[model samples]
Target chain A: MDRLGTVAVVGVGLIGGSIGLALRARGLAAEVVGVGRDLASLQQARERGVIDRATTDLSRGVAEADVVVVCTPVGRIAEDVRHAAELAPRSALITDAGSTKRGIVEAVERSSPRAAEMYVAAHPLAGSERSGSAFARADLYQDRVCVLTPTARTASDRLRRAREFWAGLGCRIVEMGPAEHDEVVAYTSHLPHALAASLAAAVPADWHPLAAGAFRDGTRVAGADTELWTAIFRDNRGPLMNAVAKLQDRLSSLKYALMNDDEESIRRWWSDARARRLLFEAQQPPEA
Target chain B: MDRLGTVAVVGVGLIGGSIGLALRARGLAAEVVGVGRDLASLQQARERGVIDRATTDLSRGVAEADVVVVCTPVGRIAEDVRHAAELAPRSALITDAGSTKRGIVEAVERSSPRAAEMYVAAHPLAGSERSGSAFARADLYQDRVCVLTPTARTASDRLRRAREFWAGLGCRIVEMGPAEHDEVVAYTSHLPHALAASLAAAVPADWHPLAAGAFRDGTRVAGADTELWTAIFRDNRGPLMNAVAKLQDRLSSLKYALMNDDEESIRRWWSDARARRLLFEAQQPPEA
Candidate 1:
């Protein structure tokens, strides 16, 4: 892979800082710049060796970049990408790590035509419940699935560069349309988070002590940052709502089977579930 | 604590074999006899030192026991308890490890009055996706919550003996009425399992490769035994349905908030969920 001349990471949070760290650790970028609203976080990123330079101005920070990754909250991704597009050279490839893709892609196309042509919406399907630059790790994206959502406006060169950039960071690049990306992730990611939250809220306080590994594992994603998840839910409402409806239908069938004491139906439902889960486990990459 | 003199464990599967292993490993039982419909499992249990003796005849196996734990599948628990009560010594304390308590308790009370007096409905809130005697471990229940659901028909001495037996195996005994146990576990256990299955079924097959830790953890319980879970859901239909209703309401509110783009409401809902999950994690016993 060709080494990036200058790489800029906006937000300086867990994802942004980790990207900077990975870029620097792999020598993928000659200079890694951290950009965020929080001066303290930017300074910490620099001090932690996640970046070679720190800047509070997004436009100024990304002006000299060969590649710019907008890692802001889902709500702020569009504006930051537009800023990066306006400031950076036209040849500089722009991408994002937003959880949702359709909204961000649409906003970019509407607000910045030049950036729209250069921008490729991407979401790395990896994270921990822990947030902030302080918890950023260099190997966070290793062997993880990073979905690239490219619009019709996205240039082939820019798209190819974005894919190679993520691939260089040890990610398995999966190309998808923005709408398809949003819908697929709504079921695989957003729906599960919502279910976890609902499960966490529905259980009685008295039952907390008796909660074993099942409850703990089931509700683990409920511990995510509220503001970030709220933005994700709001930004990807259409697909997420559809996913929820599908999940509710599945749940309703199980409930109906239980209520009617339909042993065969219940058995089949569970057997299908068991089979699907086993298939998923078998297909997963060996644990790193 | 006085040693249990000849503990007979019925079914000799994961839970039963684990109980036998824990009893013998901790020197809590002088002799642990294994009873099962499968001769091979009983023989394996004996060879693995999970039990001192193996038998296919339930009556002959438990006739001289001081304690008889009926660890059959949830659907057959009532019948197994009645058989243990008829076959075991009159002085033996009879108990069961059924996931749901109300149905089992009511069935026992109605079928055999003698068993109702001696039987304590217990559920150890511990298990793995793996099943059978092959995966049995001595410390399966260590520091795990074991709910004892004793009805009015349950004698105080028998209940105490059941509590002591679980406590001796390093379990934390929690006493609750059968109905309360059903309701609490329906939300904490059964509802989560149903959601996992629903999530597993709703996702597209192509999304499996993109699944991260969140998806893996969320659907972990979907891999559990289909027959075993079907029995549990059928046995606890009322409470499990009520739990599903509660979870659906919670999910609906979240969906409504997202659909309306109600950022404030979404933030508040997620904040509450995060807080509740953190509180639950804080209260949990240190992971074994």
Candidate 2:
């Protein structure tokens, strides 16, 4: 396996720290630099062996890198990607781990031509409700899907490098049109988050004692980082609202069934849902 | 430490089988009789040590019992409880483990005078996505909350006996009005189920491969029994509808935030949900 000379991980949070750790652990990168706003957090990441070097200066941090992975919040990913592209060597590849891709891809296209050519929009579908460097693990990307949304203007060499980088970290890569990626993820990820938060908010304080495993499992994602998810929802608002509308339609049908005491309709609805879930579970790769 | 001479368990499914296993394992009952429509399932329950005896004859099953715990599907619970009440000794206590309470309590109240006096509606907040006797465990009720919804017409002696029975199975008992129990559980249990099912239903078939931990956790309850949940929705329609409305309101606010790109509103909604979930987690008893 060919190893990169240097890999700069901007933001150094859970996703970035995990990428740094995985690359270092796999001997895929000779030097892993942690870049962030907080010097203390970057230093902590270095101390934890998540990175080999730490720097609060974005330009200085990415200057010597062969690759730069922008791991900032969804709202900041485009700017971070553009900055990484401007600072890194001409041959260096730049990519991001933003949950939403269309905005980032379009914003990167509007950046300087050289920066646009270096950037690939990527979203690795791997994370927990917990966040930050402390919770990062080397195996976070193992057996998970990482979607790459490359525009027609994206350089082929850079896109290949982005795919190789994620593959090196054990992610199974899938390429999708940015708009399609946003729409699919809206149903699979964003809508679920919204529903979880809504369920959590609907629960009366006094009803907490009576909640069981079902309630706990259903609302687990409601505990995810607020700022990160808010940015995601805002960035992909159009597709997310469409997803919400579809879910509302499904819920309304069920509500109507219950209201009418339509046992057959309710049974069919739940049965179809169960069948779909079982199919989805069947499609999952075996646990590592 | 006092044990009932005999305990009759109606419907040898997960809850019923679990109750039988716990009663026998803890020596809370001298004899545990399994009763259901399927003779083979009853025999299987006996063979698996979930019961000491098996019977398809409801009358014969409850004839010698000191207590009868109705564990049939939500739709059948009322009738099963009434049948158990008619068959059991006049001194026998009757209770149920239906997820919804108001309908069961009302139906029992409309039953014969003896049945009404003997019945106490109970809903145990413990279960997994998996169902049936094969998954039943003796420790299912350990440290779990079992809500006893007793009406004004419920006899004091029977209520006391019902409390003792669940307590013996390691359940912490809480008494609530039947209507209150229905309303509370609608928010905590039924609404979550409906949302999980709807989310599962909304995901496109192609999106399943991209689904990760968040989707799995959000839709876990969509795998629940269809007929069982359908009956529950029908039984608790009013309160469940109210719960659905509250969830819709919360979701609509988030939708408005997303549509307007109001990051602050989105952040605050998710942050409040996170804070509430943290508080709920803090209040939970240590996992057994």
Candidate 3:
């Protein structure tokens, strides 16, 4: 596989900025250029050493890049792909770092007519409650799982290079179809975000001051950028909605058992959940 | 208020062991004696400097203690309270660190029929994924909240002493009725655990190996000891069951919006949850 050379990262937010830092810090990329809407933020990212050259002009950043990673919000990925495709160097591999896959894949297909065959759908499964480039850390991806969704049209050589690119950044690469990826993440990630958000809403303002560590930690992810998650849930509506329905059904069963004072039912309900969670928790952290 | 001196911690597992260590490190207690079901665990606690002494005999530990704090599973709190009550010094003030309030309050009432005036129902909202004496940290309670349930029958002097004791250990004390406390925690704590468990169960086994950081962090509290959480849920059945019903209804509404591709409804469903969660998350590291 050809070594990932000059790279352009569109949108120097937490995920984008961190990927740039990690690529450079790991010697995976010789040059890392950043593109963003805010010129001042790009300059800040450069001064902080997240990128070698930073520009507000998407054309300037992607003109000579060998690899381009689109890191815009779900709603805007199509526009970004279109912009990057026009400026991208010939044979440059394109990919994204979005949470949902199907919408973004469709966006790429529609926008990047030229780079469509080179594009791959990827989601790097790492983030912190803190946002912005200032909070970006090169080590954030270490031992984390990063998923790649490649369609039948995607070039084999490009797929290999994308896998190598993430592997170099210390991520264990997991490949799946875009549809399967959405279904899995809906239950594992999106549903939890929704649950946390709802739990926070249910608490009265008077009692909020007294909310303990459990509530705070449980709802921490609920504070994630609203616009971004709004688009994510909107894009992955089918699978996420399915997961939500399943969860509602289970919760309803538990409520009935509790309301009816069915001690045996309650005991079975808790024991089952406990068994699976404990097993998951016991798994070894991916080989460091 | 009488100075907290020679605090006795019964059943030195996570909560009890940590309390002993925290009291000793902060000089909140002159001496701490650890009482446990297992002699080896008690011995380990003492040797680890969590307590000044260790004993398997409940009577021996309670004889000279100015304050006795029971930290065991809620199912056994009554039996343990009765055992310690028989040997507790008449002037000693007794409290517990169980998750449930009403059941434990009733247990304290029944166990110490004569000395019930000296007993206070308390629950300190501080813990970790790690358990046992080995995981105990001195500053575990720093900036944490502790709830004190003082019924009309509860003595004012006993309440004052319990508050002072917790305050010295770096807990901000809040007053609430047993019923109210359980109701609030049902949404804030219990229901969240149930949600976590449900989400964990919903994930496919194949995806379990590929579970990412968010899934792990989101479900950390869900992997709680089954026996402990079971006892707590059962003890606070009325409130927990009520909260579960509300959560299920809310979740069902969310499912409906998602299933029907109702963008406006989904947005409204998540907007309030997101706003409230953001507000809660904005309150970082509570005032020390």
Candidate 4:
């Protein structure tokens, strides 16, 4: 395996820290430099051995790097990627692990077309409700799907390099159009988050103990960082709203069935869901 | 440690099987007889040591039993309790692990006043989505709350005995009125089930692989039994509907915020939810 020399990771939180950990552990990177605005957090990542070196200076961190991975919050990813593009070597291939991709890709193109070409918009579908360097694991991306959203202007060589980067971390690569990727993830990822938060918030504060396994499972993601998700919900507002509508329709049907005592309709809806659950569960790659 | 002599468990699935296992493991029961219409399932329960004896005839199973625990589905709990009450010894305390309580209590009282007096409706808030004796565990109820929905008609002695029965299985007993129990669980249990099912059913089948942790956690309860949940939804229809409306309101506010790109509102909503999540998570009892 050819080691990527001096790989720079921006915004060294869970995703960034995990990327550094995986790259360093797999001998995929000769030197992993962590770049972030927060010096204290960068120090923590360095101490934890998630990164070989840490710096608050973005330019200094990525100056001689062959690759840059922007693993910042969704709200900050485009700005961070643009910043990294300006500081890193012109030949450096920059990629991001943002949940939503369309906005970032569009913003990068609007700011600098050359930066957009060098940037590979990739969304590695491996995230946890838990965040930060403390929770980062070396195998976080193992056997997980990494989606590349490439448009007409995306550089083919950069896309290939991005695929290679994620592959090195044991991710299965899939290409999707930027808009389509957003729409698909709206249903699979964004919608579930909204529903979880809504369901958790709906439970009366005084009656929390009455909650059991179902409530816990449904609301586990509600414990996720609020600022990050607030930005995600706002950035993907259009598709997320559409997803919320679809969810509302489904819930309305179930409520209608219950109100009318339509047992047949209720059973039919659940049967469809059960079939899909079994199919999806089958498709899930076993954790490494 | 005085053993409860000849305990009869009707409709021995996960709940009944777990109760039997707990009692047997603790040496709390002299004999745990499983009574169900499915003789094959009962035999399986007996073979797995979840029960000491198996019988298809409910009357024969409960004839000489000192205590009868009716662990049937929500739709069948009332009928099973009445039948068990008719056959079990005069001193036998009949309790059920049905999710909904108001409907069952009312039905049992309507059918037979004495049966209602003997039947103390209890909802053991310790069920897993996985059903059947195969998933039964002796520690299923350890440190979990077992709610007793005792109405004015409920006999005090029988209620005390019901509390003792659940306590023997390592459950914390909480008393709530039958209607209140149904209402509370509608928010805590039934609503989450409905939301999970609805969220899962809304997802496109082709996009299943795109689903990850958030989607999986949000829809886990959709993996539950369709017919069983359908019955539960119907039984707690009114309160579940109310809970659904509250959920809609929560979601609608988020939608309104997202539509307007109101980051402040999104953060506000999520902060409130995060606070509640932290509080409830802190209150959760450690698993034994």
Look at candidate 3 and tell me the lDDT of residue A128.
Answer: 69
Tens digit per residue, CA lDDT, model 1, A147-264: 9988778899998998899999889999889988888888899999999998998887778976777788999999999989989999889998999988888888988988899999
| Clashing pairs for predicted structure model 3, backbone only | none
Candidate 3: residue B95 Cα off by (Å): 1.3
Error (Å) of candidate 3 at residue B91 is 2.1
Once model 3 is optimally superposed onto the true structure by TM-score, how far is the C-alpha of residue A176 displaced, in angstroms? 1.1
Off by over 4 Å in 3: A1-5, A110-113, A260-264, A284-288, B1-6, B27-31, B110-113, B260-268, B286-288
Task: Report the C-alpha lDDT of model 4 over B1-288, residue by residue, as the tens digit.
Answer: 357899999988889999999999999988999998898888889999999999999888999887899988889988888888888887888998999999999999998877977888898888877899999999999989999988888899998888899999999999989999889999999988888888888888888767889888888888888778878988899998889888988888988998899989999988888777777788886651
On the 0 to 100 scale, the lDDT of residue A132 in model 1 is 91
* Ten residues in sequence with the least summed lDDT for candidate 4 chain B: B279-288
Scored by CA lDDT, what does every candidate get? 0.89, 0.89, 0.80, 0.88
Error of 3 at A267 (Å): 3.8
Q: Report the number of the highest-DockQ candidate.
A: 2
What TM-score goes with each of the models?
0.97, 0.98, 0.91, 0.98
Clashes of each: 0, 0, 0, 0
Candidate 1 residues B11-127, lDDT tens each? 898999899999998999889999998898789889999889999999889989999998999999999999899988888898888898988899999997788887899999888
Tens digits of lDDT, candidate 3, B1-288: 445667889989878888988888877777898988799888988889989998888888899889999898888876676666678887888888878788777766766565568788888888765667788888888777899998987888889898988888888899998888888788877877877777777776567855665566567777677677767777888888778778777777877777777778877777787778766756656462
DockQ of each: 0.82, 0.83, 0.57, 0.80
Q: Model 4 - which docking category?
A: high
